[model samples]
Target: MAATGQVFLLLGSNLGDRGQVLTSAREAIAEQAGSIGNQSAIYETEPWGITDQPVFLNQVLEITTSLLPEDLLRIILNIEHDLGRVRYERWGARVIDIDILYFGQTIMDSARLTLPHPRIQDRRFVLAPLTEIAPDFIHPLLQKTSSKLLQECPDTSAVSKIP
Candidate 1:
């Protein structure tokens, strides 16, 4: 049997019925990726890199998966495509965006993916929901808990919990 790994995934949607899109993405993830072990409350956050887009509804999910990191990335990309994501520009608005935040302490940087997501500490939108669910989960490289990272995060763009 394949070994199951714990993974943190960030789901965001800024276009086309954002809440419904996130709900659909979560359902798709649970069906195709792994069982979701935990999830943070949805948050409304200002656009990070490119501020011109619509605000995003974001949440973090803790998942248990048997797929390897690369395979998981492939699955996530497919999920996004299925949900109407179109790659127009970096940090562009999308119908749904699912990002792999952490994959069981595994760290690798290739053309396709990065573990502990390179900008986790630099984006409040990512950190807010992450801190909600995994406050004590330490970054393998930064050696800080999610809460600590959020405390020190400089993104300051505004992240608020939503109903």
Candidate 2:
């Protein structure tokens, strides 16, 4: 497969059975999004955006898919809904939060989606795991590698890998 269709995704859950939630989400993703390639070790992270919520178990994944970026977004939203994700507030605790971190080399800036996720440069929770699998992957917009982004990240929230 060409590199253009390769995509990176982040999954976070702070509600119930986080590990199981992630596992099932991965299964649904393979069915709707594409094949799951490299996946990072799950990380336990403090809340971001809204710090008054439960801490999250986060995981990052690399996928090779035929679905267009928007289509993939639709599928992820569906998965989140199926997993009982409720967006009562921004960055609030969720059953499952699936974010499209990167979509190959595509740089999109639309109302619905944005490629090379705008906040990745500062989120250690996202960068930590992403660097595990795609350390050298470049941010299409920032022109920086994942490792560099993680090193330079300013978000000080605690992050630790889980077995």
Candidate 3:
């Protein structure tokens, strides 16, 4: 049997029914990626990078999976594609966006993916939800807990939990 590794995924949506899209993403992840162990409350956050787009609904999920990092990336890419994602612009509005935040303690920088997400400490949107569910989950390379990262995050963009 393959070893199951703990993974964190960040989900965001700014197009179509954002809440529904997030719900569908969770369903797809559970079916195609792994069993979800924990989930943060949904948050409505100001757009990052390209700020002209609509605000996004974001959340973080902790899951257990046996697939390796590359394979996991492939699965999530397919999940996004299946849910109507287009790559016309970077940080542009989308029906759904899923990002791999961490895969156990694995760290890698490659053309395809980066473990512990290179920008976790810089984005309040990512940190808010992540801190909610795994406040103490340490960034493999940063050597800081999620809560600490959230406190130190420099992105001034607003991030608020959805009621």
Which model scores highest in lDDT?
Answer: 3
The Cα error of candidate 2 at residue 149, in Å, is 0.5
Candidate 3 lDDT, 1-35, residue by residue in tens: 37565699999999999999999999999999899
* lDDT score of residue 67 within candidate 2: 80
Against the hidden reference, what TM-scores do the models get? 0.97, 0.96, 0.97
Which portions of model 1 show Cα errors greater than 4 Å?
none
State how far residue 99 of model 1 sits from its true place (Å): 0.5
Candidate 2 TM-score over all chains jointly: 0.96
Q: What are the Cα lDDT values of the candidates?
A: 0.92, 0.91, 0.93
Select the stronger candidate by TM-score from 1 and 2.
1
Q: Lowest-lDDT window of 10 residues in candidate 1?
A: 1-10
Query: lDDT at 96 for candidate 2?
Result: 97
Mark the regions of model 3 whose C-alpha exceeds 4 Å error after superposition.
none
Worst 10 residues of 3 by lDDT: 1-10
